[model samples]
Target chain A: MLMILDYIKEKAEFINQALAETMDQLEGVPPVLKESMKYSLLAGGKRIRPVLVLATVEALNGDEEKALPFACAIEMIHTYSLIHDDLPSMDNDDYRRGQLTNHKKFGESTAILAGDALLTEAFGLMAAGAKNAHLPLDVALTIIEEGARCAGSRGMIAGQIYDLQSENKKISLAQLEQIHRLKTGDLIAFSVRTGAHIAGASQRTLQALTEFAYGLGLAFQIQDDILDVIGDQEKLGKPVGSDQEKNKATYPALLGLDEAKRKLSVCIEEAKGKIREHDEIRPARLLEIADYLLSRDW
Target chain B: MLMILDYIKEKAEFINQALAETMDQLEGVPPVLKESMKYSLLAGGKRIRPVLVLATVEALNGDEEKALPFACAIEMIHTYSLIHDDLPSMDNDDYRRGQLTNHKKFGESTAILAGDALLTEAFGLMAAGAKNAHLPLDVALTIIEEGARCAGSRGMIAGQIYDLQSENKKISLAQLEQIHRLKTGDLIAFSVRTGAHIAGASQRTLQALTEFAYGLGLAFQIQDDILDVIGDQEKLGKPVGSDQEKNKATYPALLGLDEAKRKLSVCIEEAKGKIREHDEIRPARLLEIADYLLSRDW
Candidate 1:
């Protein structure tokens, strides 16, 4: 456990440094626009997605340096989605990760453009990185296409619209899982798969990693739902039962608390099982991440 | 003139068909999301950007089929920008091309997501197209990077922020031009450059085409300003003098109506001259397109 903690910390620091350098290199962007983009992108977080990318690459014995741009690109996409989701027209949240939301700090218009710039520049960075890293053109193109499909209309955005529609309505557990699967699951899967594909993993290896990814994604969401129901207000930075208060569909809402926790355990175990089956790949950190999500309180 | 008009109309229909087929192929997107995306994309216009891509490829005697994906990609980017620009937080316009703006037709959140989807999927389509077109990897990477850079923070988004900041405030002529140059000019320049680059035109040809693109972009904006000041209202699907009413800085506002018209003429002539220098490329349609903009009212 301690070793995994140290690993995450080290990789997260590396990711943060790369992200900061990327922002510094954006010389052509307007100063204020760059500032807003950096605010969300550089805002300290668990850096889970990027860490997964690096860890997966390392697990596959690939060059971590070659994966850095992709790691950064995924993080940028994540940050942009958060920024847009926080807008008045969307989730309308005032704070995120203990800081003023983007639209709260920057005006809505700037916030929107910042998100736009981040999303657009993410592709630019990835393409440039692919060329610099000397990745094969076909591999680069496939990875790019995967990123777009996962993050675009058919994936995360689809989840968003569905989530919006499902609000204030009673939805079944299957429907709830479907939303999380597309909304957050696809990107997380893409992050891990990107690392595997870049590392030249076999098709069988890729398949195992993908299953592990989806399991981890679902477990993460279920944990969030569980925490929202039974979490410390001060520690969680929001009131407990807020999901219930909003009539939002959640795992615990549909299943009893004990059942939800049991489901989370099953997800974690299943995820770890998939990784363990590929023991030759050195997936210690990936397994640890699944366990971390299972036990995390906030 | 008649020939150029016919060329545009014919190419626009082809572009429109391709766009419709692309939308039909998006089976994974939620129906509502797809509907909103199609609303803006298929709303119909002169299809200027996509047409330029095809025309430039044709002028260089390259495979028009190979350039179709890029042409569609540029149009998608253009449509996405318009969708977001019409959002309440941005331009707050209620009508575009004689139809209700995206947010007006669909709710604000869906509209925002639709714009995001279009932007994201444009890259996906381009990547897939690059592979199908069998474009050289280096060339594909360069073009994708160019699209991202031009449409991103340092380019169109920068222009949008600057334009927002300068609203209702006095801005210098150079500043206003700078805003439009980034906002609209960069993408226009990208369109022509993509076609030229894909057709494997020489550095000299690319440089000339780039200059022509920028000139035409500025001329188009200047003509828009001229129309806003002195042209018919209903013909434009919006009222004239709207820019004046909002105190928005336009070419005509900054340089006076007659001077702005003169500037437009200069831009058109210079743009045509650049193409004439490369008569070996058979740039008649490109030259005529510049002339078309010079005389367009709405």
Candidate 2:
């Protein structure tokens, strides 16, 4: 288990490096705009989504190299969302990942353009990846379309809209679940499913992986909500009780902290159970990820 | 000539309808956000880029249907840039294409998201187009990469950065040309070239088209600069002298109005000259476009 954890970490680092190199190509941009994108992108996170993509592909005995572009694309999409979410018109966050947000480092206009650049570049990278991998055109096309759906209105954007409108309003637990599933879960599902699709996994296997991702994603968001209410700011790298301060609805707000934690545990268990039918090689790394995410203090 | 013009108009209207239908598929976005995207996108414009794409494809004797998705994709990209440029953080303009800007109608946050959504959806549309056309993977990949380059840092975004930084500065005529060429010329070139490539045009044809587009694009920008300094606001649908008021550099500022107009004429002639080697079918429509662009009074 420890070895598997270390392996995932190494692969995550590799994906992060690839992401940096891909973003570094934007150096041709004016120094200010390029720096703005780099400031937020390189500020560093766990690179969990990219890792999930790499790990899932590896578990399916797929070429890790072939999956690298989609991994990078997913991270770019995630980064763009963070940048926009931190803007004054949105969440208005000044700090992200324990540093000044993109808008604070670069003016709002540059930040906005940087985010747009990242999102557009993600598609370019994905297309280049398809060429590099020699994948079937249909496969590459499917991945691009599905990835966009996950990131666009029916997915993350919709989740954000719901989040914004739900602010300061008391919403039901089902509505909260819908928001998180779309906002957070859909992308995670895409990360795993995209890898599986690239690897040409059996439809049955891909379906199970998706269910596993869905449960894990929900668990991840619930843990996040619990952390917001009770976690330490030092570890979380963000102010605690921010959700409460902003009257933002969360799993904890809907289910209470204890209930949220219990639900998270159940989600983790269910996610692991969904993948049990898979061979040891394919499910082991993802199961470990579910454990790590649900148990993390931050 | 009239028959071909009618065919082009019919295709353009079909492309417009396709674009509108595709945009209407943006489910789950907030009504306000959806309205914002639609408001700018549906606002009447010439649909020039997409029309150029279809025209190039037709001129190459390729199936126009195969190019439709790309046609819509370029327009989406163009619209997204306009939406972002009209934001308060950027140009701060309240009007575009004779209508209120996206930011004015939807607020800054929604406008930003609308742009993001449009850009993301463009990729989705391109992928779908690739699938529908049954083109080879490499061709589809190239189209996506070229489109991304036209929209990203070294292309439209870079142009915007320089435009912002050069505000209030006394830039040389050469510097102004570089800015507009990157901001506007690169994408227009990409629009023509992508269509040709998708149609499997010869290297010689692609090269000739690139030169033609560059000349035409430069002329287009010079005409815009000239219009801003002298045109009536009611006809232009926006206030004139906006560049002067904002201290933004323009061709007229560096080259005088008469010189700018003369330069535009030279550009139009050069653009037409490049395509003279091609069959009459290729140069005819493009030359007509150049003339129409330069002849516009507002």
Q: For each candidate, give the TM-score of chain B.
A: 0.97, 0.95
Off by over 4 Å in 2: A1-4, A279-281, B3-11, B279-281
lDDT of 2 by residue, B1-298 (tens): 5654565577678887988888777666667667777887778676778888877887778888888888888888899999999888889999888988888877887888888888888898899989988988888999898888888878999999899889888888888999998899988998898889888988889999889888988998998899999898888878899988998888888888898889999989999898877863366666676777778776
> In TM-score terms, which candidate is top?
1
True contact recovery of candidate 1: 0.83
Interface RMSD of each: 0.7, 1.4
**Candidate lDDT (C-alpha), each:** 0.90, 0.85
The top-ranked prediction according to lDDT is 1
Docking class of 1: high
lDDT at position B124, candidate 2:
89
lDDT (tens digit, per residue) of candidate 2 on A152-198: 87788878878888888989889999999999999999999999989
